[model samples]
Target: MQRYFETELLDVKNFELPKEIYKHAIVVMRAKVGDHFELVTADQKVHLMEVTAITKTAATAKEIEVFEQLTELPVETTIVCGLSKGDKAEFIVQKGTELGADHFVFFKGEYSVAKWDDKKQKKKLARLEKIALAAAEQSHRTTIPTVAYLSSLQELTLAADEKGLIAYEEAAKEGEKGALVTLLKEIKVAPKETKRPKLQAIFGPEGGLAFQEVTALEERGYIRAGLGPRIMRAETAPLYLLSSLSFALELR
Candidate 1:
């Protein structure tokens, strides 16, 4: 079943679909009365809704079943990526959402090649938001991840706070490992009963983080962690980190 999001899905017993959703379901998808689809409301409830009526400008659906499912990371992990060139940020956001990232943040790294001015930043953010929404629906996620941009490493660290990690290539070469596993172990216990741990991991752009940036992160209480023995690209690192999180937190 297709999934749609509405802020007021549970406002009434049955609600008229939004204009964009109505057009997609009626005109593009050719959905008719009696068809069933999923609607995620403001409170993050997923309901199997059956179409009750359709008009030129509106479509109405009522709940048939409420799904008691949680398709999110056990820990509230946020990926803070250093700004990279081209569509790298888009790729990261799309795949990262599917892989269960709670939030995505991009910052201006010292070695970053791409710069986002005010106008372009807004446009890029809008595009990334759309990609995240589509990916969330396709992956059957209950919530769409938030996307944000920051100015510097200092701002990023402040936003993430003490519960953060930095993916450094030197750590990989140094044969340092298990930092993430240890962190996950400390947070993944009895997830249903315990408060969700908020974690943020930072990654560098094309040239990777400067030594001073890594040191600064360490000084700010971010533990330096390695993905594995292999080095990953600007886009690949976040996907790898998210997948690892799934393995440690969800699959295990």
Candidate 2:
């Protein structure tokens, strides 16, 4: 059952696939009239629809059945990572989406090696978005994660909420437990009847966060926690953080 995220809520009771969708169904999938496939509408509702007519510009499907299932994380977690070099940012977006990241923010930091101009920034953001959407569909996620353009540390901190954590290796050296462990403990102690808190986990780039940047985050109310004794790569850290969050919140 391949799933596609459509822009509109389809009442396939008497519906037609848009030109792009039609080509994918009729030509790409080689689906013909009477063939059935799973369709996810803009509202995130999943339905079983059968092809009724195939046209040059579109294909029609009749809604046969629907399954109301919700597959989302218990807590909405946004991962804010400092911009890294090369395609590492793209990797973060793709893997982060599969790991159930609700949103992503890339910030230019003092230690960041990659620099993005206006045109380059737009292209990079667009590419990240496409990767996220594909990963979402593959992972059976109802909603695609958002990828934001690079921002400054000041801008990011100003927009952050009270429930955020920043992963800094020095925190562990100071006898603090790993950030993931701390977050899990917090979630476990939270009242079950209460709504889950939104956790934003921030990671630094290859060279890691500068001392001043880390201090700035601390002043902005971000608790600095570490991951482990072994330092993880810039792109790998966020995936690990997100996977741990999903396991703690959703799989628990």
Candidate 3:
């Protein structure tokens, strides 16, 4: 069934769809009166609704009952990376949303080649947000991840929680174990009575993070870790990290 995220509450009673949604539901999807579909509200609850009336600017639906049981990731994961060139960042946001990232932060790094002015930054963030919303709908995620732009490393570090890891390729070469592995091990060993862990993983741009930046992150209690032996592209690293997380938490 087609799924849509709507802010309005749905009940067995009649309801009207917004103009844009009416076009898609009635004209695009060719749904008619009595057609059924799934709707997820802002509160992350999925409900079944049946179309009652269709109009030029609106469509009405009667909510039947809740559909699937709501299931979410046990741990919240936030991926912060240095802004990279081209459309890679957009791709990262899309795939990251499907893999259960709670939030994304793109920061200006010491070695970052891409620069965005205030106006350009707003546009870029907006585009990334659209990608995230579409991805969330496609993946049936209850919540859409947020994308943010950070001006400096200080701002980026301030967003992290107590459990954070920085994905530095150099760390992998220094005989340190893989970051994904290390984080999983830590989670497994955590006491059941402990609060749910929140993880923020940072990645670098094309040229990677500056040594000074890595040192600064270390000072803030972020462990330096690596993905693997081979150096992955800036765009590909986040996807790799997100997949690892999904396998550890969701697939297991």
Following a full C-alpha superposition, what root-mean-square deviation does model 3 have from the true structure? Answer: 2.2
lDDT of 2 at 47: 80
For residues 143-162, what per-residue lDDT tens digits would candidate 2 score against the true structure?
88899965688876544333
Clashing pairs in 3: none
Greater lDDT among 1 and 2 belongs to: 1
Sorted by lDDT, highest first, which candidate order results?
1, 3, 2
| TM agreement with the true structure for every prediction | 0.94, 0.89, 0.91
For model 2 the local lDDT of residue 242 reads 78
**Residue pairs in clash, model 2:** none
Residue-wise C-alpha lDDT for candidate 1, range 1-252, written one tens digit per residue = 798877776434577888988987888999999998888876788888888999888889888888667898877889999999989999999999999998999988999999888898899999999999999988988889999998888876544323788899999899879898888777766345545678899999988999999998888889899889998899999999889888877784
Leading candidate by TM-score:
1
Q: Give the Cα error of residue 52 in candidate 3, in Å.
A: 1.5
Better of 1 and 3 by lDDT: 1
lDDT to native, each model: 0.86, 0.79, 0.82
lDDT of 3 by residue, 168-244 (tens): 98887886776668678787677754445788889998889999998898888788877877879987888888787
Candidate order, TM-score descending: 1, 3, 2
> Candidate 2: lDDT of 149?
69
Model 2: lDDT equals 0.79
